[model samples]
Target chain A: MPKKSSSTKNLRSALRIDPEDGVVDLADYSPRKITTGPDSRKASLAALEDLGAELVDLQTRLYADGVAGEQRSVLLVLQGMDTSGKSGVIDHVVGLVGPEGTHIRAFKKPTEEERAHDFLWRIKRELPGPGMIGVFDRSHYEDVLVTVVHDQIDDAERLRRYRTINEFEAGLVAAGTTVIKCFLNISYDEQRERLLARLDDETKNWKFNVDDITERRMWPEYQKAYAEALAATSTEVAPWYAIPSDRKWYRNWAVGVLLRDTLRDLDPRYPKTDLDIPQLKRRLAPPN
Target chain B: MPKKSSSTKNLRSALRIDPEDGVVDLADYSPRKITTGPDSRKASLAALEDLGAELVDLQTRLYADGVAGEQRSVLLVLQGMDTSGKSGVIDHVVGLVGPEGTHIRAFKKPTEEERAHDFLWRIKRELPGPGMIGVFDRSHYEDVLVTVVHDQIDDAERLRRYRTINEFEAGLVAAGTTVIKCFLNISYDEQRERLLARLDDETKNWKFNVDDITERRMWPEYQKAYAEALAATSTEVAPWYAIPSDRKWYRNWAVGVLLRDTLRDLDPRYPKTDLDIPQLKRRLAPPN
Candidate 1:
């Protein structure tokens, strides 16, 4: 079960990957592990619904703080392979929050204009304003993962991009933004089942891209790329959390827990108005 | 009562302001009117919940159409006075739909750069791509309403803006967009109660703006401005519907119904795949 927030254990830490702990290994983490979520699907779904109500409150408070000129915001970066539920998490998890204060961006293949600029150019453009929760379906981390796996960039370039990303995140942290990077870790076999499921369901056929199969063929190479990239860029300011994704319910539950805890820690307050309340109330008493 | 969809009444027409019918006289409509929603608050709330589940399915199908390269999209433009519940409708109504397929843009005052360009420039930039639902808290109509009300432009200039806006919306329709403009019809007393309530509640204090009072003081001017603008712009291409807004429950229920009916009318189909399904399924027979 997703442990109660009041519990002595720090549940957020359970998902975090601290590179200093060891060489980050993807093989060690089971994609189906129900580390923080309820074991049963029925209870897990209930837990998630309960969490959604709490998340909405926390998120709106953060938004209210921004309205009072608070600079802090949260950025939840979602990274994963095809069918690993990046969009699914966004729909099921972040969708729980009101869109008024939630900003979502799903990055696509770089346009010629975007490619002409630096890798972070388009990303910088889409950053959520103060008090908003920004969910990135894919992020600048793609630079360190996809290109490197495809042989478009060498180790030296990848290393430089890593440094650039760290500095970029550091700047964001200094500007009062908290970054939560979630790596949705889905297993190869589980992915095959998902892709096949899409093919079997006619309504889901639009989601079945031929490129997904091509990308899955390079799963081992992509896994190595992600393991290295996650290790390289998972900074203290913005650490990467590898979310087990073979079980969709568990993955959503875990991500929800991460967000709820992060917002609670921030604990944004409703701004105390300096306006003379009684005087305003008196003024408003007159009928138009 | 919010009549069932199967009824022969064509309830959507009751809310819509057809320009050919007559000039939209705001005096004829009651802010507390329960024209197209259930009479009792409890029933309307329950009805809204029921409508939500059906709306979600319709919205996703529209999204699926976009994934299959369809060009159609829906834009719901919300306009009203202070505390007319624009954001509330989004949180309560549109929030039921997944954020993946829904795009929301809340326009604040134009910055220095925005004022430097044509009024429609920023609006055009934020138009939803294919198979999306776009909600505008305030929209291009503001040029004709707010600025005109404040007398920033002469009558001729106001007429020019109305023409420009109509052309712009026409362009959008020609490009396969269905525009649903809703003028949330909240009363002067309702605005006073809402603003006072915001100040009375600690958490809602952040939403209490001094500017809201200044604008609320101009309720009469704003209403007249809205009436004229709605009549001018509520055309064959994209008509404006005056939604009774004193009852928050009815306001949300009405908007939800508007969206559901529009999508159902459009009847977006899931895209059919041309890929060789059998061969791909067979190729997936070999596991790595």
Candidate 2:
């Protein structure tokens, strides 16, 4: 096992929710905490840029190592409320990696075909191959989060889904996937500000949805639902980190730190070649 | 019908194949031809940058128009030989358009489930929604090209596919989709150079496939197959443009120009809202 870095240890202690005892209240987490030492936004952003560059190298190695027979992958699951910076995190943080090894799937409302199968069927189809970094903009967690909030599934069904999710994630981990799940925890006040900004800016008007306001009305119920789901689903194999996301710079930085640390821990190495290098070199040399 | 611009007219007249005649010989077209006037590669790339900016605006309007009720879209079908730069076109040209309005589907070899359905069934599932710019990295054209080259389908099946493709494109056209098909034409020598470069570069080694070399040996067969397929499927509603793609700058610019002109022809407008402006203004005003 690799020795844990001070930064990774700090982040895990600060951000990771230990649900062994019970589910924690949303009121316990602040939506604007900047774990990085920088007090100013500019300093935090600068730090994120550094982390982004380091992440690119790590991801490239991870991809190359996977291609070389390591057969390992990473899945980053992002879940949050509307305008809570899920897309923003993808664009600013995850976008740092090259497309060659990065696969992103943004799940919309299920189609007739998707709904026809078990909920996890579509999710399984899009899993990243060996040496890939797969990102789910919203994931299987949606089944529990949305279904429970809307009362589409009764308590019995909801409990079953939590067990199913745990088993599914455990399978992924066994199959050599390191899973990282994050909840972009944004305050209601921050979300209102974002929605208003979208409505106010003509360029951003395309992103504004009237339905988001309707969801905002059910904030308390959704919060309770998320708390229960995260508590039940968070496991040793796939832990959940509630990211304070009111500050865009801090959120991006924190996620970047998490990924950089995770990749460092993985420490994927280049594959050892079995080729006869001397013979190949002689064969490739130009004829005299 | 929208009036065609001088640029669009020039491109259509110069690059479009007259499929009504017969299958055209690949030797008849020069792969190095730069349709855009500038002799310098830098000037060509500079021109592409300008076109890229305009494309962003046009795509935004196209997406907004789709959302507003126009129910129109554009599908860009790119087919080419290996190392002919299909991915390059997507990155440099298509990448200019925002993800919000752009949908890209890179079709790989068919899965068991996909093969069970008619070839067109999978294509239909991935069609861009109204107001989106959908790109098929390798599309249904693959069915005719690869299958015919390998004799995977009998002559009778091949004939049926041609008819199916033409009819399918016609249906898409009737449904308000403006189809632009581009066959990136590259010479055999250019591909050899690209393959050699991939072999030499450590980073690009991942892209160098032994099977690509095997495929290279069957180039003549593949060329003949593409010629026949293009001739059979090229229609007035969906014409095929054989782009001279040896010059990367010229290829990128030509594609950008094609899209810019196509979007200009479309002239997608922002949807007119049904809201009463005066009443909404009064309602939104600060309470006195």
Candidate 3:
């Protein structure tokens, strides 16, 4: 642990930031000026990898205790725009967690059955158990976003849904679930470039949709919806951390850090035991 | 891909198994005859890791396309008892998938809210998007196992729920969701030893639950529950594979093989595109 702390200290020094620095304000901090050259990219990737490994190790330790006690669980919710890299965050961060301890749910369009229930109906089922971590990619907030932006639901209904979501998340937090909400913010130009790249590349062509481009034209509406969503739902229990995601690498790094911070705050440790070596030798030791 | 195949062939050769040989009957294969020498352990771990990496790469390719298309997804369900090495399987296999294309959901005991809904209700929301892979650890099958064995519901309800689960799985299959269910079968003696070790070791004490031992005592009931679950749910659309899990290393290897087979069958490829370089350049090139 000392070695880890020292290494982090060195890396923080290299970043020329205080080791105790909280959120770096992206509003004023120009990522372009941050200069993600080869060295920086390598460092960022390494940091992500480090954070990922730590998160997994911590979660595993927590699960071992969790399954033993069968008493506690954590739920992490990731809310981001299309290609805000929600999938990437899942791919990178939870990727490190062992399957025994970690579970992820990626919510999509509502089915007829789902439509019959409240928007939160499907999500509540996927919550993590005691000693488990559950991740939601494009979670219940979609009801607030897509429904609002596309005018699929009336404004009154949408507002009611927002309150419902807030209440739902509040319930989860009250139940001892640590809810971490992240909003990935990618610049419109960057999104267009990525979408076009997908369109142009043979291997990426499947990702391009004319409908997505049409949706891109509604960026202002989507932005307004996002701002409102964040404003309405970012509570003390489940605050929204808006990640600057123009650079894919940075998105990965930021999410990893946030996860690490959250899990460390969890302080999961191996459950204590009183070993009886003599008794165990009689039970587990092979017959001579 | 050819290199991977040939290497897998070499691996098969080293294991001295016929290429056409299907999964062996574990009951007929004596455990005493199997030596757990260092060489064998290394070989098994290496093979599992190789297979896991291949599956990750394959899933990643599928996911990239899925993200582009937004229409296809893969649902992987892994069911096992404690210490059945589900984590080992996921750790090795998904370790290689890029951070953008995979999701995992681990089902725990129902919350107060979850218990209020139908068993499968929460699961429906967590389905993977097209091109993404969703892994469920101890999924809706629990509705049958826990409820049936505990007599929490009547036999008629259990049967109905079983049918409901099968139908739900089949629906997922029809909806472009490939369902691969894996059951890890470890012997009772091994489970007891593992649990005792968890209890004995201070580092692992948190994982030792008096309830796990209680559950272990209900082994016969659970076994019957599993057998019934397997019989009822294993279908052409989504069949269940029982992996011999007395050995953690072998369990990981077997699940990795199954995942590899499933992903390979999915055959995710990069979306095709006609990228006119001139057009791309005209779109992105700076205005002189």
Candidate 4:
């Protein structure tokens, strides 16, 4: 077993939005704020080296505990604008752990079959089994975010969906899934810069979605939709954390810290042996 | 882009079982053989650090290509007795690439639902999509190995399944999935030592199955089953590689090299864009 790396840092509370805080005002949150953990890019990267090791240990324990029949699991839901580095978190942060234990699903445009069902139908199919870390690149929240920004859903339906989401998450929490949702918040300027960078880099051309510019035109509408959706759905059991993500290093480290802390709190032990060790040891001897 | 680490070493050919060679004699193969790549444990570890960077690059390209509609993927099928370190390869080998691009499934015994269908029915369900790396810990081969040894299947049935597996693999290859099968072969003495070590360690007790002792008692039967299976199914399109796995470091590094080389061979490229760059850039500007 690796030596555990514990810290007093409470990234969870530092970044969490309280239910009473009500609708989040996008302007109040800085895209460059370092609320906890490392304050500089270099330090965050350096700290990640140690953090990665600690995460691997915790993740392994979680997987081990699950293999021994523990039913609990962790789910991380990452929601962000195109350039907010959602995929970056999966690569640099979750990349630190063993792939076998991490179940990742990047929700794309709804397929014909998917569109036929309720929003949570597809999401429910992909939930991680016991002891796994489930990551949603974009999640059921997209049903609210994208649809609302485009005015596809009416107020009555949108409000009803929020209530449905809350009930759904509450069920998940009751069934032993610790859900961590993060809204990777970046400034409008950051999105423009990232999109431009993709345009300039020929290698990144495939990632440049033309619709991103079309969406940028509705920036204000998106902010309104996001703020309202986050506020309504953020509950005590599954609150939303607004991560300032202009700095890629900070965003990656912050998510890594959140995962590490959650796994640490769960404190999944290597399960006790059900087998008779002595008898098994004797049986294991080579034939004479 | 990091400079590619090209090597003359063909670990694939060095380790692959030739179909024309007929049945493999386990005694003729050394469990600690290092046919290619780093010969020393420390050197293999160091090489893995560099290999990991190469793999991450290749895996990223493969994923990007898939995103751009390229339809090619890799499947690695791993089979061995307990304590042969199948999970170790997952952690130390496949873990080098990003989790988003790798799909790992460790097949336990067939559930009631799995048994109701054809053997390949469940296996087919887990096939990796475009640009993903699929790994099966104990795969379709188990039907031949375990059932045959336990007298559940006759010789005629075992041979028929081999033909079915070959055709299934040929179909997968035809559909752009490269299949690599590895039989992690370890000596009886090595298995004994490893089992004893597991029994000694309290933390690893969860991994120590009492059934492993029962399996070990039927070691010769398993060897016969494995050798015959490898011989019958090893084909030009999908060959079985008998990996010498007594040394955990060698086994891990060997599998890593297999994945790295396979990805390097595919050489997936970041896709070209369909959007007009200048027009998009102009539209990306914020309102004055």
Candidate 5:
């Protein structure tokens, strides 16, 4: 068995929220925590670039391995409040790999048809096939997170959804998917600044939502809901990492590091071909 | 009614294919046709940059208009053979706009469930919502083009699909979608070079499909299918443009110009607010 890399070990210790640790308090995790050394912003950016290149290689190997009949994949689930920079991470970190190997699905308000089925129905359909990197910008967690915040579902139903999510993730794990869920932890003040920036910029005005302000008004309630959801669902099979996302560069860099280390832990290999190499080479030689 | 811009007029005259003209022969079209002036590659690239910025503004207006209750949207349908730079056009032309307002859907081989539905079922589900710029990397056109080439469906069924596509597109237009379809036209020789390049680059080997070579063997058949599909589906509501795509820079420029003109024609306006401006302003006023 291969051992986890030191970088992976460091990231796990720094970010992972183990369920056994009792109820999680959102206030305990600093949104601006910098795990790297002082004056390390430039180094973090450079390291992110390096990890991005390595991710491209690892993703290709994962894709090739899948093509060669390996039933493995990686699903990166991003959950966060508005202006938490989920799209930024997607554009900078996940976008490094070729689009062919990356499957991005942003779940919007469920249509009547989608709402007719179980919450996991549409999600299961969109899961990355073998050898693909699936990024869910907002995922089934919304079933619990938003629904709970809006009082759309009762506490009993929310708890049931949690159990369902755990089972669904366990099934994915058994089927060879390494699920990495990241909750972009941004502070109330940081979110206010970001939302204000969106309103002020003409180009970004389309992204500003009155609903976001309404949601922000209920910040404490949301934080409580998130804490409960994370504690109830974070499991040994699929863990949640509370990423300090107040700094855009740090958020992007940290996600890249986590993904890079996770891929390294998987250590996907290029499959060997079954064809007779000498015979194929002889067939392809110049006719003369 | 607003008159079409001179650039739009020039592009249409240069690139639009009239179905009434009868039977599009691929041999008659030059993949290297430079519609702009000679030695204008630099100017074209510069113009593309300018148009890209304008597109960002236009797309925002379109999105804002939709948010303000206008039901308008744009759908860019890109259809082409392998190595024809469909993804390149998407990345360079459409990617300039922020992802928040852009919805990209790349269609692959249909699954067992998707196949069970009518051909257009899955296509309809992925259509861009109001206030969005939707890109279909490869769309319903595949039903007619690929199925016809491989004899997956009968000739009668193929004709029915053509009619179905026309009806589908007409519905989209009636409902306020400005549909622009582009066929990236590249030559046999150009495709061969591209495929060879992909094989030569170790980084791109995963993108090298053995099926692409097999499909190349049937290039003539595929070309015939495309020509038939283009002629049959090109209509007043949703016109088809046979873009000369052997030159990547020119191809990107031409598509950008077409989209910029289409948005200019639509001329979506930013919505007017109904809020009490004085009260809101006072509430948000900075503290002394």
Candidate 6:
């Protein structure tokens, strides 16, 4: 791979979050058993709800402030292997941000036009406006991960594309875009189980494609691709945080916590207005 | 009042939508009512689910197609006052469009940057990308309706805004953006009753402001603004349809009919691809 810029190198270094970082990581570190501690399951549920409510309030304030003109935009890119719960992640994490400020764009197969343009072209076009939070279910990372793993592109070309992606993300960050890239890291066994469960449920048949597991067969290739891609592109401007996704509830909490922290860092302030309600009231309504 | 445009004059003269031909009048014509005639309620419930699903499908296809090089984009702007059931309209309408293909952007207040720019500036930034459908809640029309009714701006500014909005909408259409503007019209009695109901519910108190009713006091102003706004802005490119919003069931059904018809007109086709079972099988079942 070509040498990365100083900025890209810095981003890559900052995002190396520990295996157990906070309540979020702790909640998710173990999959089968939830460590609620002193809090009962009911209390845990309430706590999560409370966390969710706080997150919503913070996000709402950020949104209102942005609308009032702070206009700080955060673009969250979720990349993971099949059955990694990208959709579920979005449904739960973004559930905190009211629909008014959050914009979700899920990328599927490249259209004829998308195929025509550079891989990043389509994703770039869908970037959220200032003050809005855009969430991508799967993003341009697919170019480096899926396509590279499947040997859709030659190795030389894949390396060049990786550099291009690194540059592209750097440009986005330079332009005041906060890019939060998250990888839903689930064990292969857990993934197989989830896929099987989906297959078992008739209601979920629409979601299960046998091709997903077929892609999983290229597991090593994909893992290598993800490792290289993250190594190449996770810059100080846009870092990739790998979230343990075996536990769906914990995964949701982790994403929510990350979102809360990120928004808090932005510190969006509401716009001030001098509305003299008392005088206006006197003018509009005569006192008895 | 200024004289109507040649095109507006022609449309009004040719079509008997309003009682008054020359002057734009809200009293003359109300939104088309969706009477719960027989199976309407049941049909609406079924259709609401279909609406969301279809929207998702359409939105997904549109996004993909646009990235592929298609110039097609659809903007479904949902405009209504408080309790006009804008949320319900979105729930029912977007439900028709499956979650896959649709991108819903609910515009609340202007961000600081958005306010710095003109009213339509933020709106312009949020326009749907090609191949996907963008839904707006309380769009730029708020500049005219809310601002005017709430005395945010003067009469001259309000009239100037009408023409500017008309041109703005026309420009969007000319740029290959299909703008479908729908206004949910609920009656005074119905609105008052809804407000009373909201007051009765402790959970809903947060949504209610004493001044919200004060805005309602300017009902005639809002009605007049909407009438002129629609008349001035409605064009061959982007027409405004008034949907009766008193009955939730009827609102859903009417919205369903409109969306179903619009999507049918677009007639999105699935990508042509052959599923090779052998390839899938080989990938799923690795060689021994």
Model 5 native-contact share? 0.03
B228-263: candidate 4 lDDT, tens digit per residue? 898899899998887889998889888888888888
Q: Which scores higher on DockQ, 4 or 5?
A: 4
TM-score of 4: 0.93
Preferred candidate (TM-score higher): 4 or 5: 4
Candidate 6: residue A144 lDDT (0-100): 81
Give i-RMS (Å) per prediction.
Answer: 1.2, 4.2, 4.4, 1.6, 4.4, 7.1
Per-residue lDDT of candidate 6, residues A71-178 (tens digit):
567888898888888887766567455455567888888989889988888887789877778899999889888888777898898889878887888888787678
Give the CAPRI rating of model 2: incorrect
Q: Write the per-residue lDDT of candidate 5 for residues A125-224, one digit (tens) a residue.
A: 8898898888999999999988898999998899899999999999999999999999999988798778777666655666666667678878888899
Q: Residue-wise lDDT of candidate 6 within B1-288, one digit each (tens)?
A: 122223422322222223234346655444444322214678657756655556555555555556446678888888877789887766556644544345686776677878898888878877777776778888888898878777899989987987888888888878777777777778887777677665555434344556766877787878877877777776666777666677777666666656655666676654433345455444444257
For each candidate in the order shown, give its overall lDDT on alpha carbons. 0.85, 0.79, 0.66, 0.85, 0.81, 0.66
lDDT per residue, candidate 1, A35-79, as tens digits?
555787788789889888788888888888888889999999999
Candidate 4, position A112, lDDT? 100
How big is the positional error of residue A69 in model 2, measured in Å on the Cα after superposition?
5.4
In model 4, pairs of residues that clash are none
Using lDDT as the yardstick, the better of models 1 and 3 is: 1
Q: What is residue B173's positional error in candidate 1, in angstroms?
A: 0.8
Query: Comparing candidate 1 with candidate 2, which one achieves the higher TM-score?
Result: 1
Q: Give each candidate's fraction of reference contacts reproduced.
A: 0.81, 0.02, 0.52, 0.88, 0.03, 0.08
Which has the higher DockQ value, candidate number 1 or candidate number 4?
1
Deviation in Å, model 4, residue B105 alpha carbon:
1.7
Model 2, A67: alpha-carbon shift in Å? 4.9
Candidate structures ordered by DockQ, highest first: 1, 4, 3, 2, 5, 6
Highest DockQ against the true fold, candidate: 1
Error of 2 at B237 (Å): 1.8
How well docked is model 4, in DockQ terms? 0.66
